[model samples]
Target chain A: MRTEGATVAFLDIEKVVFTYPGRAPVVDGVDWRMQAGEFHCLLGRSGCGKTTLLKLAAGLLKPQSGRIVLRGGELAAPGPQVGFMFQAPTLLDWLSALDNVLLPVSLQRRPTPQDAQRALRLLDQLGLASHAQHHPRQLSGGQQSRVALARALVLEPPLLLLDEPFAALDAITRAELQDDLLRTCRERGTTVLFVTHDINEAVYLGDRIALMHGGRIVENWTITLPAPRMQAMRHGPAFNDYCARVRAAMDGAGT
Target chain B: MNPTPMQARLLAAALFLVLLGLWELVVRQWGLSALVLPAPSAVAQALWSGLASGYFWPHVRATLQALFLGLAAGSIVGLLAGMALAESELLERVLKPYVVVSQVVPKLALAPLFVLWFGFGMLPTVLITALICFFPLMENTLTGLRQTDAQRLQLFRMLGATRLQTLLRLKLPMGLPPSLRGCAWPWCWRWSASSWPSSWVRAKAWAPWSSPPRA
Candidate 1:
């Protein structure tokens, strides 16, 4: 909600509303703004429009009533400046891990040799270089999701939209991914909008957390927990305080 | 039934012999003429004689040529039409009703009209073969394309892949092979097996009755 000065918003959703045919609005007139390099988590219950909001921000869905603007232009349709990672890895089964990472590059242009090298480097960063030639099915669940993240990062888009990307993973793998993402995005200075149902996950990873209920954001909090996002942060008093606040905000908020 | 490969083969052979024996008995007991319903032995003898004389080779070659050509041509039309329907909602809306209606009409009824328009040659028969084959290919291909992974499709769109790029990079790889199998393996087999006989290819042999088809 605060942009400080004359900085053009990296991403903006102004009174956006979306609904399925013959149904009530799934995403009501909700407005959100994210500055560059901010890692924001959208936390909510299962049917609380979190994924819909992420999709709207990613330019995969059109807001039925209002609009979403990205990088100073109306994001009427999906464009190259945004990256999306869904709940599943969605790696092409026919392509190798490295090839999966390079898919966006290959789709937009004839990827140069340098582009391929960059893809390999991304795989290396994700610790999947050894499995570059392996198909998606050969990789474990956490590994596949990491590959998905690598694919999303291939373009180094200014904004990344993730929809509960790690909820399916075991706890240890989830923590490692959270840490890796924390270091990687902050270093790259990428703005991120991550969706999740897990409260601790939000507290663990978000620089700011927005809690959505029914069709709108009911609460927003800037978490000042110490970073590097290690395991100790999960048990810290500040972390628990933020969690309790989020829980209290959820009580009888949406029907 | 419960056994090694060799035992399975022996069981198949035993069933074949018993089936032939029953056929032979039923024809003999009914006192049916050979022309109406030939016994298995009579049919085998005719096949042996036909082979010895090399009488059916040209017809066999003609049929195979029509079949493969029909398959290749039909596949192209079917896949392209299916891709169009999948990529554009407008095309799907415009074309799907006609496709469903075409399927409802018996394809054999169109063969005579084709013959009337093109004359009684290989073209008419080839056209009929293609017509018979394309429907299954189109239907199966449409199904495959419609069934592509929603997650992958969203990824393709969000990455700003062009429609052509999405078709080539995502849709074809995911849909083409399954659609090929759907039409080529089972659906086409059942439909073509039942349909091809009523088509023009069979007309030449049956001019009162051609020799039973070789395989």
Candidate 2:
């Protein structure tokens, strides 16, 4: 969960519509706004276009019509300003963990020594310092996800877009990673748009949650639970209440 | 029960010795000419004399030079062509048929034509060897480049990577292992290629003694 901050719109998606070739609109007339430093989750069922919308925001896909503005300018193409995490970790199997984290920098030019140090620091922050030299094949699913997270955050982008990054991990590992992600993003004040189908996960990590159904956002909630979300909070009545509300909204959308 | 490693080794050694003895006896009894089938003992003796006199060194050097030079040239050309074809659809469509036809015609068949054009010595041999070595590496490299993970490509796109950066950083590195496997084809072909030139063209200093071919 993000701490309270001044209400400044960091990303503005207004009536954004996107349809694949010979297919119906996957993201249709979607309007969304996020304040700077917000941790927002796009909660949805499968094929609901939440992932499509996230991709559109990341500039990986273009909308059929509508403007996606970031920091008061059009976001026509992906740049260093937006960090992205795919559904899978997507780490290069040939590269060591440290090298994978340094990819964003190395793609442009030879990485400076400071860039390497920063990548190492990010890995350390994710509890992967010792595994820096280890390749993706040597790492567990959880460790690989952490490395992907470090890679996403390496450039210290102002906006982070993640599409179910921890969906593949086991429960205990997922919880640990959620905590790590929350703490890291909060420290950096990186505006996050996290997409997930897991209601509990959405409640646990988001400052605000938007329920997307049939390529449109059907419900939005500003989570009222106290800040500094803890593992214990998942079991609390407040958290369950939020999850229930989101679940009801989802069910309503299905009907 | 499976034989122990030492037992296996001894068994293999005994089999080899028995075969060699059979070969020696058959040749002697049948009055076989050396040209028809040289005895195993004769082969061993020749090997010993050749090495002992250092008569084989220059031939070995020549064969090695052709093998290495042809391999290096063939592989570099194949890799570059593969990169170009993989990057451009129009180029692949236009050049791929010619490339395929070139490979379809046997390299051995091409050796005589090469000798006619380039004349004797290493040049014609090297050309024939390089032609033989080219195709497999190119095809493998192209397949590898095209087979890059789609998700990984998306990741690169999201990072605003330039076309060159995407090719070098993502496509090329990912394609290397398969392309290296392609080198195996050229390696095996080089041996046969090394001997073909001397048979077709004027005998180089390293040419092994052999009967002339029927016209």
Candidate 3:
């Protein structure tokens, strides 16, 4: 995504700390901020609390020690402005692909034809337009993940929180979806905070990358790559440089 | 010919006749009392006569009315109770023991008392049917509601789904297909009430044996 005004902060998570009772804190005291339309990736290994941090942002969990503010409003719960996608496809398997995308709206009222049209358009954008009526079991793993991505975006939330949503996919599908997600988010100017363990994904997708170690963001980088990251970008020097930086931070933290 | 449908049916009919013939021959050969051992043909003939005379319709209608009313009422109540228990831990803690206790005692043991209170007509029979249906319906529906995937529940929370919306959109749908396996059990009980010899067992308990006159 090309930069417009990068000055406006869309999400500010201040000194957040969270723990499951009687255990060590999963997310230690940490501060992070994001601008509108910026795609930031929180890269970390398993159990380092990246997902917990995303959940806190989504208002699915409350941080014990700090607060998360969106658009100057302190969030006590998940509002309409933020959309979340979990690692699992998390689509209601009983629902069709189209209906699953329409789920966010369906909970409010009977989804109007307009809502359905919007869902169909999103499926179309994700290349799942033709499989709208198919059940989740009928779709391939990659196809199901793409449908989930469509569902996450169907609400047109200004902020999207994705926690390793495509971790289970094959390489080719993951790359294709990463490109689709980047293009879509870039076009809509959606502020995204995506979480992942893969160095290559964080390097390829994020406008800025934050590496989490031991429950805190230990390293953060503003990627200066041009818009429309391509498949060939993986073999490029700049991409390798970003990956090395992320990997070095990972190894340096020894987490 | 590779067993055509019509031919298969014909074969079935022929076997049925042969079985009846053997039954009749065995009864005749043994000279058994008809009351003790009616032949298959005799039973079929009696059944046909009852149907031909329209003698069975009112009785059938009465039984069906009881079954449907019992099934519908019992199922609706069971679902509501199940939902209430599943949603509230307090309610589950308070009421689940009572449900378990009720289930532990023989429900059929109470059926006769219902007859005494409600009279011998449709009300008592309907109560029996409802009692037979209540347990499975409540248990399965509760299990289904409780078994909703945790991730899906998280999704509901993220979507800001209200309690009703979460129950309807997520829990209800997820619980259905699996709970349906056990949910079907009530229907079996309902049919057994109508078609099976269950009433015979009841009657044996409720009525005195026929041959006795004590001096």
Best by DockQ: 1
Clashes in each model (backbone N, CA, C under 3 Å)?
Answer: 3, 0, 0
- Across residues A99-218, which tens digit of lDDT does each residue of candidate 1 receive? 788888866665679988988888888888899999887999999999999999988888888899998999999999998788878878999999999988998889899999988998
Q: Look at candidate 3 and give me any clashing residue pairs.
A: none
lDDT of 1 at A65: 88
**DockQ of candidate model 3:** 0.24
lDDT for model 3 comes to: 0.85
Order the candidates by TM-score, highest first — what do you get?
2, 3, 1
Candidate 1, residue A177: CA error in Å? 2.2
Model 1 residue A70 lDDT score: 82
TM-scores for all candidates: the values are: 0.79, 0.86, 0.85
On residues B1-215, what C-alpha lDDT tens digit does candidate 3 reach at each position? 59999999999999988988999999999988989999887888999999999999999998899999999888888888998988999999999999998888787788889888988888877777787788799998799899988898988888887786676556766778843533443332233323237545555667767535667
Off by over 4 Å in 1: A1-5, A15-31, A64-69, A252-255, B1-14, B17-49, B87-101, B109-116, B177-215
| Tens digits of lDDT, candidate 3, A1-255 | 225975535798999999999999999998999988899999999999999999999998899989898977888898568888889998777667987898787655556799899999888988988899998889999899988888888879999999998899889989999999999898889999999999999989998999888899988999988888999989999899989988988999984
Task: For model 1 chain A, give the 10-residue run with minimal summed lDDT.
Answer: A1-10
lDDT digits (tens) for residues B118-165 of candidate 1: 998788888878877888888777887788888888888888876666
Better of 1 and 2 by TM-score: 2
